[model samples]
Target: MEALQAVLKSNFRSFDRVAVIGGLVRDFAREGRTGFRSDVDLVIHDSKEEVALLAEKLRATPNRFGGYGYKSGPWKIDFWALETTWAKKHVPMQTLEDVLLGTFFDWDAVAYDLWERKLICHDDYLERLRTKTLEINLRPNPSPMGNLVRAIRRLVLWQLVPGERLMCFINEYLDEEALRYMQKKEEELFSYCVSSRWKTVEEAKFYLFQERGSDDLQLDLFQIKHQR
Candidate 1:
């Protein structure tokens, strides 16, 4: 964190507003215990062009995700343009509070203001993190599949169990439409994992079905057939 802080301070200190947001902030709040594989997400309350200029200044190459990223030692730093509308309404994201409000999950609605050197988070953000609870900050109204998958993944990774409300919401709220959306997402993710070599079928199945243990006769038969 010190090294990353130094890099950001040196490069973006002149900027008026800057904050480290997303999973990195969550990991930071966990006292460096939660392991994050992705690069750090930094939000600058400025135009995309301005962020592109900053990326140039920092010698970072353009990333495919409409951001700038560069690898420094073991850490990967990414800069993202701050936007107002993350889910539904298009609210201008001028303040840190706006960003927190736009977050998909309560636990993720935490940020460390680099300029102020302080943490800004939702009222329940810390509580949710502490309790390891997955609560929705913004309603997954249009599509709930992504959020559902994320919640389940976090539950597995964090070893935290969801409350009854969350379970009821998942089981009751999902209709045919939501189930179709989830199936599509699963197919797309599976294709990406295969094509990008991100995860083999076995690896994907292992993580997705980790709780099922290794005693599945179907999986055993499939492996035996493939080995022949």
Candidate 2:
């Protein structure tokens, strides 16, 4: 970890709001699990080039992780030049406002904002991520028993949501502009499933069923569980 901080301080000109998030953050603080990787994340308030420069310097270092070609920066910058994407998904503003901001995550793997710490790098891009997230409609943390319920809701919404109707929505909705947000979320789903010891959603669904242990609930493709 010290090597990571040293590389960032040496390579990058300046940065802020550089706290880690995602599985790495959860692992260090909570007892959460994630797929094993030597890579250390530094979520900084900086540009892609800023991150890339750090990775280059780290590549020249002698550390074992570095020697073994372990990544020392954001995972995406290693790839070719591409257009960045962002999203304005509906998060419950009401819930986000109530969350105790500032580096908080739960055992359930839910993310909450750190509203107090603010910094700017790359023309305040991190600020934009934080502020824009405020507009996101956050939902409450789901209990162990809530998995099946939430899955059922998602399954139903897949049918009811407007964009779910067409593959053209893939091209239309997933325009170049939306790729960053889409890819970011897609990676998240991958990490969660891999780390949680669930091979598929069905396995998690069965676990949730055992938690609920209620005969009243019935599984069906079309049925919406506990309508919101």
Best by lDDT: 1
Query: What ranges in model 1 sit over 4 Å off?
Result: 32-38, 59-65, 84-92, 140-146, 163-228
lDDT (10s digit) by residue, model 2, range 97-213: 212122112221222222333321224323433331111122322231233223332323322221122212222333333334433443555332211333444453344323331
Please give the lDDT score for candidate 1.
0.64
The C-alpha local distance difference test score for the whole of candidate 2 amounts to 0.31
TM-score, each model? 0.64, 0.31
State the C-alpha lDDT per candidate. Answer: 0.64, 0.31
What tens digits encode model 1's per-residue C-alpha lDDT throughout 1-228? 577778788877867888888888887676574555447778787778788887887799976656788877777888777752343264457665677767666777888899788899856667777775666666544456666766655554455555555555556544555545555665666432111212343443334334443355356445445543
Most accurate candidate by TM-score: 1
- The reply for model 2, stretches above 4 Å from the true place, is 32-37, 46-204, 212-228
For model 1, the run of ten residues with the poorest summed lDDT: 191-200
Q: Residue 52 in model 1: shift from native, Å?
A: 1.7
Q: lDDT, candidate 1, residue 114?
A: 90
